[model samples]
Target chain A: MFESADLTILAGLLSRYLVVLQAQQALLNSCTHFYQLEPRLARWLLMTADRAYSADLYLPLILSVQQRTYNTADLYILRSLQVAGCSVHWQAANDKRKFF
Target chain B: MIKENFFEQNHLLREFPQDVQQRLFPLLELISLPLGKVLYESGDPSNFVYFPTDAIVSLLYVMESGASAQISMVGNDGVVGVSLFMGGESTTSRAVVQCAGSAYRLNGQRLKDEFNRHGMLLFLMLRYTQSLITQMAQTAVCNRHHSIDQQLCRWLLLSNDRMPGNDLHITQELIANMLGVRREGVTDAAGRLQRDGVIEYSRGKISILNRPQLEVLCCECYAVVRTETERLLPWVFQKGCTVKTTEASMSAAKAD
Candidate 1:
């Protein structure tokens, strides 16, 4: 288990791709309400990312799982990176960890 | 055709043939996206492709009782509605705005029309689709494993990247909903962070106090995700964006 501070910087670096660009207009314009849920999403992704070992291979595995489950490509690649990390640990370990 | 703006945001854009860029660019539109908005719902048909210029959107899976958890988030570095290019018209997840910003929204048909032209867009979207799937699978794994503190640390890190600061304006209750856990769980996690001097939370606001310490408490998931993102999406991170592994914490974790 790592300290929270180190994890924050690491997670932030991983998620830099999630920052929005300026000047682009939203078709639905629903960020404010969605923003309300960011903390939860962020925390979930963060927790998952912290558990996984490698992002490169892990990301591909995540994509594979979603491809099997969702059958659509409308997913967040960056966020999935975090999820892959978590899944690796969760599946690899038999113990039930109290996360997410 | 992928435009300069699109190319600038995505490194993969440069790998495309000029003709492909030209083919895809005309279809791209400059649009604005607001915060906390719903772009698509579970089972709703997708109608457009979104390339965020300055916004972040969350892909959420809402439970039957209205409880929801965010599966992922998209921003400038990516495009929304990859299913159009990936051969799907809809998905089970809902897209909502995680941050209040802007993005270019392209009509789903226009995007597909251009994609049918098929060259760079086809390949790029496919790779992107692969990346997105990775996140969803990882999410399921993380939710099932890891400690709450570790999870909180990972969450903070992801959010920190989307903004310019350590402070985030979000409520614990809202976070609980997103995590698909009870509000008390978030409160407890926040409380622990506060006690440890890792964060300062007041009302709905959270200020990261010690990033290194927070990372120390988290599992390897955060680093794995970040490293993968950097690898798959080159040009997104600057040179030598190393994952800092402090000596003190390594010893501490081992000792514990």
Candidate 2:
């Protein structure tokens, strides 16, 4: 589902947001499957990717396994993003789309 | 015999040519791999090759952001540091103790010296490496294609195969972390399995209640890896449930 363009965009997004080249690449390298993420997951990571230097922004998407439920940890990240004034749009792949 | 006592406890070490076995036994340092202990990290120099007698070590890739996922698992059927022999002085994955138990470790230099002789040990290690490769590749495929529920079954089966008992001391969160999935997904799947009596999960421990039912729920990936492992390492056996020991069984070789 991800591509090099997405990676370039992700790296650009992360680097520009974090402003640390070393940290950017390090986070990218650590997240082995960084570009192969669903759009929603990528956006979620990008939103939180700027919180300090803990740039595990692409982590949620790196593991090839698919998981559907949004647990407390997932909620915590989304909640953190919302509290920071970033409106979060969370959706599970199987859930029906809401117009709101 | 005192020095060689535990060699029999490890299938790989036991199958070694007597001359090679004699050379390695004294050098082997029997040690305990406590659960969650990080043995090596990505790009770290491996100083020793660990031969797990009962413990299971997971090879995981940790992201710079601290997220980690397992790539493969090593047990008594294999060695821990294949990158040492595969010409990479450092590995790209982290080795962690999954099922804490005993293992025999040999200094990397000594292993290299022994492997340089181009004998049965080297041949066996190479064969074992092939099986490890299959497992790593299969894990990648499984992670990419299988559902979290199916992956859990595979993980449980693989861990169960390495362990000496039916119970596993791991949490859904850890399993989710290893599978690179959401904890909620694991929680749900484990709950379903628990409800069906396939397993009993509580207090971060999962006990396999019905082995046959668990097998019925797993994907084909489990069988493929198990079969390939036995094919590559002819000595790898269908282990029966036994008491897991924390103490190093260095004297177990005497029984062989």
Candidate 3:
């Protein structure tokens, strides 16, 4: 349903995004000992927001998908973000509420 | 000295200039790499660099808590022990044989000497290193963003590309270790894949039943690594194409 030109442009943009994402990941991996969790979390949140095109994001789903458990530091980081004008909500797994 | 034909089995060695091949062939020691063989442990000084002809090696970064994840994989299309030529005698990653096969090993010093010549070997090694970096970076991103099922598909596709057959002689436990996930997670994912008719797993062996479906199910990480690798090392794939064409023409002539 799409024209060739449109597909080409989309492919180009996707490739550019991948390249930048790769560079960012490589940097984070190489400097794991140098950077603290706060900056890393902030960067991740900002990138997620940009990609999702919304400030309202779901962290629990991401945590479950990555098979990661939140520690005190992670909870503290979320609280700090909430204090910085970002609304934070905790929803149970069975909750049917949709906040878009 | 091993037979000269053995060199052709490895794409990187196959593309060596005739003179370079003649010089290097005498130095290569062919050895069988068994599954779970530790080529080099993390932080250990590497003594030899291996050019795998039919083996798959996983470069894993081990954490302090004893967990590890594969950063990249090296097979016939490339060489192991980049740190040897990259001027680092040791790396934080451990290289282990993921599949049982043979590889031609060269003394680390000998490879370093050859690399310093700034010839075809140097050029190829640099390009291969770039591709390896791309793979490692893509793996980091995949680990962060992709689901376990998608990651398993990506892993299978990448491993399938480096070997000869549709069957992979690896266990779910080893795959779990490589992905840094629980064994149960891999079991569930592999089960789903089998149910979908994409693969068949039986007693540590996995046979890919439908490659097209597997690719469709894989994440973009696999394609990103494959594209970058082919772009950085075009000669590796080109050599394969040339051989296929030569065989086809020879068969046609024989038929006449």
Top of the candidates by lDDT: 3
Tens digits of per-residue lDDT, candidate 2, A40-63, equal 344435555656366533334434
Residue pairs in candidate 2 whose N, alpha carbon or C atoms collide under 3 angstroms: A30-B64, B5-B250, B5-B251, B5-B253, B6-B250, B8-B253
The DockQ figures for the candidates are 0.02, 0.04, 0.06
Instruction: Residues B172-255, candidate 3: write the lDDT tens digits.
Output: 999988887899999999999999999999998999999999999999999999899889988665665222213343344334
What digit string (tens of lDDT, one per residue) describes model 1 on residues B1-77?
Answer: 22353334433444456877666566655554655788888778888878764456777776555767766667545
lDDT of 2 by residue, B148-171 (tens): 889999999988777577888887
TM-score of chain B, candidates 1 onward in order = 0.77, 0.91, 0.92
Please name the candidate that would achieve the greatest TM-score relative to the true structure. Answer: 3
Superior by lDDT: candidate 1 or candidate 3: 3
Which candidate tops DockQ? 3
Evaluate model 1: give its lDDT. Answer: 0.58
Cα error of candidate 1 at position A63, Å: 34
Chain A TM-score of each candidate structure, as shown = 0.24, 0.22, 0.41
Query: What DockQ number belongs to candidate 2?
Result: 0.04
Model 2 misplacement above 4 A: A1-34, A37-100, B1-5, B238-243, B246-256
Give residue A35's lDDT in candidate 3 (0 to 100): 39
